[model samples]
Target: MNKYNDYAKKMNCLYAELPEYLTWHKDSKEWEPRKKQEVIGRIFNCHPSDGEKFYLKLLLMHIRKPTSFKDLRTIKGKYFDTFREAAQYLGLMETDSTAEMCIEEAATYLMPAALRQLFATILVYCSPKNPKQLWLKFENFLSQDFEHKKTLNQYAIKHKVLDIIAYHLDSMGKKLQDFFFVDDDIVTRTHDNLFKEIQTERDIIIPTEDLLAIKQLNEEQKVAYDQILHHVNNNIPNAFFIDGPGGTGKTFLYRALLATIYSAGHIALATATSGVAASLLPGGRTSHSRFKIPIGENNSKPCSISKQSALAQLIKSTKLIIWDEATMAKRDIIEKFDEMLRDIMSSNIIFGGKIIVFGGDFRQTLHVILKGTKDDIIDSSIVMSPLWQHLHKLKLKQNMRASLDPHFSSYLLKIGDGIEYTNDKDEIQIPPQANVPFIDDNTTLNTLIDMVFPNINDENLDFSLFVNRAILTTRNDFVHEINDVLINRFPGEETTYFSCDENTYTCTIPDQEELFHSLTPQGLPPHKLTLKLNAPIILLRNINPNEGLCNGTRLLCKGFTPNIIYAEISVGVHAKKTVFTPRITLEAPHDNFSSIPFKRKQFPIRLCYAMTINKAQDQTLDFLGVYLKKLVFSHGQLYVALSRARSIEQLKVLIRPSTPLIQSTDYTKNVVYQEILKATDTH
Candidate 1:
């Protein structure tokens, strides 16, 4: 116990298992190969967005002291013309075996059902080279539990496991007949083309505290809960909006309602505008995923739901529909949802005569309008809809945090309502106590990082510190810089992984590889990713919404198994839940960076020591460092940034260095569209 209690991983007399990545190096006395200097591994980005330069950058990052381009592409005696050719010859381009590695790593932590679902997702989205081989390799782990049920009949168990996999594949719009490993019965079953509804039944995994808290809902929550339940119990069609600010217990009320309704055996369809919020609810899902809302800028299309589809059946059976963060959605999207529901349910009444509950803080950022004016943005909000007038508006003014931090709560309200005193530039002064002592811009960033994560290397530091504290800025580039500074300071050896990119479209002439690597598409991971153990990272894409892995979701890295990175969900109800992430293919936005489309295959995660201000919504933190190096550029950005912390003590602001000409470091611009607040006012 004494020998194993300290840093010693292996007991002197006992045989303890270690991961394959770790091994005893006789020369280096460390679990991992020793580095010349213990510095964070750096990534190499090409000077220009060119294909050859990008490949050269990859080689430069891995190999030290490359004299020139020719040196990087030259092996022992073979001089390769293409950098990618040299990389492949060096055994860096191929990761065909990652499929098996992903399953093996996930098998150690994920539940059998979750692991199977992950495998299915990998097969569907990841495009592993050999899907059948992955199944064969992890067949025992995938159906480990069910295998015991029919141990005497191994063939039948394998068939049953394949059937379950077939069901999962079916839900994702794929068929089992394509996989040659399936049994004849499974192949015959694919003719039905069954549209299986994901999460057919609510699992009722609500927290005990939330369940018990139902009896303790403040008067505001009780009123909203009872009014909605009245219509649900009577099967009466009604539209209602639950308007509340950040800590007003909107999620608390939703969970309570879901538990009560699910317990009564009625289907309550729970969804949210964002995946993070949706994952907090029992059986919650993104409205876009659940309703199949098309993503585009042109004339919106109705959700792709046929009347006879399983999704239509789910809509028909649904007794109540709860949509969280509804205000973040555009009015057109919501109207489209209502129209889809009406047609599917065969009713003209609002939402196809189903009970609909909408909840969000209108004070938070509205639906983003790309290159839009203030009027354009406000008009896009749900409040601007004519249907908004008909729905009964319910209010919840009792902010749960107000009881604990009165001043901060009131400050948030003042900022949210645009009542704070403004200067000539229409900016509000940040509280002095909340400001990080500023020196220079660079010094401020370092101080901001230190302030947010004090004593980060301490062994006794609370794990929640990583979850609760973050440096938030308005822009992604600023986020990248802050995260880079923090990850390097974090105590652990780092590993760097490079992406395998390909042109998005088939070109007659040729595709530029350099351009593909250079395009840092919004919401996609870069060509080079550097990660360290226990470092926090944010998911840039939604893997499985039900599992709480979604775009803007935060996780702490637990293992880095080459292809699969093991991480635990760090926020929301799914906090502490273990999940495995794989390098999924991500495509550039249509006409975003360039007309020539390209795809980047890499792990869908970025260091989250700092994240953009928009992603900071719905998160309550004990410590928050606001990097105003880039002042927030959107409505409600300033308010949302300041309001994340519970109190002024936990809040710190690091403004971009004050210019000698105009000393406005104490004040920063706050963009709040107060007109939107009128529609969301107390009913």
Candidate 2:
């Protein structure tokens, strides 16, 4: 028992320092720590001793370095046995490891140092002798952490740590419930509440006074709406794709269908590829959140959703599934959902024979695979999915946003369809009316800002108006600059919130300021975040779906606490509702940092005067200012930026003079694969 305890402590110490050493960059031309390795070594008291060396060798064996586990056992059978024995003794591995145990072990080995430490601490406290006392002590340890306090709080509230510990305990033939008096029904209740909100029967009957205000669908929308409604009303199992560019009343049709279904007391599950789009629906959520889609891709695996789960039951009972912005998802994601549905319902029919309606404009963004070629991207799109053959096509051509200016709408459609005339270099000129001329005067930026943000000086200005107007940029640096300028212009006392930076596993990494500087990526709030009263900010994460605080929800800074931000929802159904947002630990993806893992503990709010075009995909702005300091590099970016404004009059484009000139018109590039569209067309 003493030997096992010593082994556990050694294993814990190794994992607590491994993240600082694991990542190797070939470009650096040497093995370099993500942070200062010496600092980690000193802090963790990790030295080049026998135990540390053994731990390193074991990690290499776990990652199957340079060979498969089977091959490694054959090549170094004796070493493999030693590593296996140590792991089993430390309760990190089982003698007869199941598939689930193997997966859990792999995830454990890959976890960041902070999480490893937390897991190790939990394991150390879990005891069969004084089960209840040990459980209480464990809870207290998590709530009042030595380090990584915010991260601990987040995982505790979400029960992520508890779930992991429970899985481990089960592997040892010990039940966590027997030890702790925790409500085992908490997870089930949370899922139930989520589904209840989604299926809530609203007052679908439109008020007689507001009858005239609810505009009737045009001929284009009527055709699609009627077809979809027909399939739903008759209980027919059908798949349909409603294809349209932005502002063609896609949302209007969605709401109408939802209303119709709810009025008839049927369940309609509405989801979107993004939180911003989802928040527009009555009880919308991101597809991943609703469906339990795995973050990392594995073509062979289905979604983590199980047949006996409440979500699966909800899916089975759902009458209609409406997926908005469907084109943004990978072909594999859709196929996986189809596969899971078939398995759950024990039927080979598509999506368990349910009526599934997918809506998106192929002219906009498709699945964005990092470092993938155009061919790779096109292949990953829904148009290339096998399920496309089963889907009936419904088209919407009317431009609701550009109804007053038909010419502008036509130009936008041309840009999206890649039919607009381009020069030999493939650059199309922008029309003068659509372009905001680059002035030599220094006041040009201020003039553009004033145009977009009218009544900025008014103390009693409607906050909603400001929230609806935003400056869209092509880069994060420009966003930071514009936000800084805008906040300085605002008439209020500025408050700076400094993040609690620490390497929870070791004390060394936080001491290296240069390391923190190098690892901090865009889309994440900085260590030092400054805000002013009435400052417009956007939520960086989906904190609470029920309260309308979701990713991309805009808010005005009303007040602040040491660890919480008091803000009023600026957009969505929860608009004007005040909410408190707490600081949380956000980790950068392994791919984001050359495969190095790190977490940033900060407030999940960023200034919203300007945001990247990629971040503005599902947002609809009343007035949009596009600052083209750099040309859009990705597909659908130009289209997304231009289509955000409700009307041409509400849009303004500022192009840097350094950009290549093309006649008197403004030139933008559009990418379209006609072959994919043809493949999706039944005709």
Candidate 3:
């Protein structure tokens, strides 16, 4: 195990996830074919455009790698002056290159309607920064074929194209106006297929389990529930916040509320700031995906929802919006939702006079900024927003987990509340009995793994057992390293898939290309993925939130196709259900992940044997393992990682017991922003 662990530390990417239909460029991670035979192999799976069938056949008969792009385009021993005449080509456009290459390839033979579908696919998957530019550039190619003998003018042709694109975007609960500017003068439609969205909400099955839970609310839970019901029952839409720590039955209260609202045939939308938390709520979805909340530096932009769009109608009809883990979201996100709601509902009140319940613990992790400081993080919290003062704060002080271990529960409170005794570095000394002994790095990790996931290599052990435990660290690097060792020891033959990598900016220096291959930016997956059947993984992108496929969702690999992997949702409400995952191009949210900005095309998943402490938020495990090789650097990170289990007895921690400049006794750093805590205190 140690040998394999050491070997994987130096990543040599030869793992094969898909059949070797493609090969990697030497000394680089770019996805391109150097040989005629490689391109021919790819063409076999996908038919070529006009004038290529005969040329392709002739070339396949005599195949070899070409010295350059010009040589590769040579067909039937004769060169096609331009790349287009060749069977496989990548035409880079100056603006929106990815979207252009995507459309140009399909434009050769696909019908105008099919091209529209391709255009929508690019919008959904590729996420072009300027959709308007792409549409304008590809307008002619997206029109009806001239062979049909239709003599429509340019204006009429463009109108037809817009209608088709609008229809396609509407089906996905979006509108072209979302990506296009308001001044673009899109042909407006009051509504389209939003009835289907409303129906899906109406069709939701209020679980009998949740129905029964309505009667089981504890005393504190009852108070919060009654306040929400009074607001909803009286048609007085108001904004309220529920302050509850982990194991305080926050999700329990959410389900009961959903059941009552859903029982009355009224729509109640359940959303959370993070996917892990969202998956726990019945009919839950991330607030960002559900609301089209913009991501990145511009946190103050309103949601991408159009006023007359289907999502607007859904929001208008929703009787209650319960946002869980509200503390983790930036103030801009919530305020932006509030602004959009007011515009849609035509009201000046907070959240557009809608019944919205924000539930979370300020003691847990707060909104994350890439390099945010103490003041930066506190300023980003919703508590800093002027709207926070108006929120009727409700408290749930009775933690459900307290019944299991009162001492552990109270200890966690002290840690979260920042009342625990700490040294000058603001680091708390953990009880020696509270931590697994740290003999050495290797021994500590091995012990933690054994404690959380025993018999990990046993083929006969149920795979479901692996889903109930995970090793968490504050850094993504640690998670990746630990997951690599654990996956190497799992009981199946391994398959690895290499992602197609390219820098966003034209690469000028050698270091930029190297960074692209190794970069695994936030929200973007890695270039090389190694996996085995039944290996546990988590979704890194929000594919289909309605189907229980969201970021941070846990799944187990079941099978693989040419470029797809089918998996079973190992946890959450959709557990045991199978879904096929397709390769999508994911762009990093920031340029800082590498020296140069880049995008990756791969399956949006990561091994879930371990995950970052932030990603593990909102998830509770019976058996938990935490490897704190590095001190947590952000507010509430230590508290979040430590509180992910019901009791200390069920948890294991592997940390260095010695510090360089100070006396250490099971001590580690704990960051708490007291200013935000003081402002958000529910008491």
By TM-score, the best candidate is 1
After superposing candidate 2 on the true structure, give the runs of residues whose Cα lies further than 4 Å from its correct spot. Answer: 1-215, 297-300, 439-443, 455-460, 503-510, 517-519, 592-596, 659-665, 675-678
What lDDT is reached at residue 490 by model 1? 80
The models' CA-based lDDT, in order, is: 0.77, 0.65, 0.75
Per-residue lDDT tens digits of candidate 2, residues 1-683?
A: 11234433343333335544434467975434345545443223222245544434544423322233343333223344544444333222223322222223323223332232323323332222343444444443433332354645553454654554543343222344655446668534333343442344343333332233235878888788788888888889899999988889898888777776765677888788888888777777778767767755453566876687656777877888999999989988899888888888888888878889999988776777878988898788888877987898898988876657788788788877778899876877666765777664246667667888876767677755687889998888888878887887777676766453334334333233224534547657866577978889998876555445567888899875444466788776567777655555676654754334556667788899988887888888889998877777766778888888777788888776554453332565556666555655643
lDDT of 3 by residue, 500-528 (tens): 66667764644243346667777666666
Error of 2 at 374 (Å): 0.8
Determine the backbone clash count of candidate 1.
5
Candidate whose lDDT is highest: 1
Q: Provide C-alpha RMSD values for all models, in order.
A: 9.7, 15.2, 11.0
Best-to-worst order by TM-score is 1, 3, 2
lDDT of 3 at 141: 79
Report the C-alpha lDDT of model 1 over 116-230, residue by residue, as the tens digit.
7778778878777777677778888988888657654886676667667766675455667765665666577644444345244554465777668789899999999899998
